[model samples]
Target: MKSLLTAITTTVLLSACAHHDDVRPGNDNQHYVVIKSVDRSEGIKEALGQATHYCEQSQSNMVVLNETIDYKGELPEHDYLKTRATAEFVTEAGSWLWIIGDGHVDDVAAVAAVAGAGKLHSMGAPYFVTVNFRCT
Candidate 1:
């Protein structure tokens, strides 16, 4: 019985880790951004700020139309907890703008390692922010 219990516990833990590995902020063909901080809330705050900056930079007359937030997981210490924010805007030229900000409390070292790999914009210790913008 004890061995069976151990096996079950191990399976659960492994599955949880796998789920964390699969966590991603945005989808392909859309702007992707990532922000990591000491806490989930702070990370989300930073991500949103970056997203707004991106939108503003795109066009001076851009107007934010809608925003949505999604919480991806539980537990901050394990780097599983994530907060994602999506905002839609309309530019002066009547083009649609889409921005996505993903925030999480993840390993600082790991986050830094991927800095500037592709769309990664910035990375500073506990906080990292990535932004993508599409206009049509």
Candidate 2:
């Protein structure tokens, strides 16, 4: 039973892991790497490890140049669509819905709630981080 659980867990973890891109040389003696992982910090850590290895191979030290983190996972199904619809309604209806009437205000309130929910839920999505480093 333990072995079966372990196997299933390993398979799920492997499937969740994103394909790692090899470190490549960029302009001006800098190196670039892109890594995606189930967790954000893990992706950044992996990039640092690759950069460290690269610098070690050249008998130099690693210096981080720049980095950008991005989200690579889709929001839960219709979450995106729901957010868009809410935003569109507000843009089309304008503030009059909230200033004069209370019914549209409820609709806007629901829209706000749904939009915020999507954002919160998306916080757990997969992370993609790009790191730039120089061997000095």
Supply every candidate's count of residue pairs whose N, Cα or C atoms clash at under 3 angstroms: 1, 0
Predicted structure with the largest lDDT when compared to the true one: 2
lDDT per residue (tens digit) for residues 8-98 in model 1: 9999998754422212334532444466554456665565555555444545332323333343333342343221111011121112111
| Candidate 1 TM-score, C-alpha based | 0.28
State how far residue 15 of model 2 sits from its true place (Å).
20
Each model's TM-score?
A: 0.28, 0.48
Which stretches of model 2 miss by more than 4 angstroms?
Answer: 1-21, 76-125
Q: Model 1: residues >4 Å from true position, as ranges? A: 1-29, 60-136
The TM-score that candidate 2 achieves is: 0.48
Task: Tell me how candidate 1 scores on lDDT.
Answer: 0.39
Error of 1 at 56 (Å): 0.6
**Cα-based lDDT for every prediction:** 0.39, 0.70
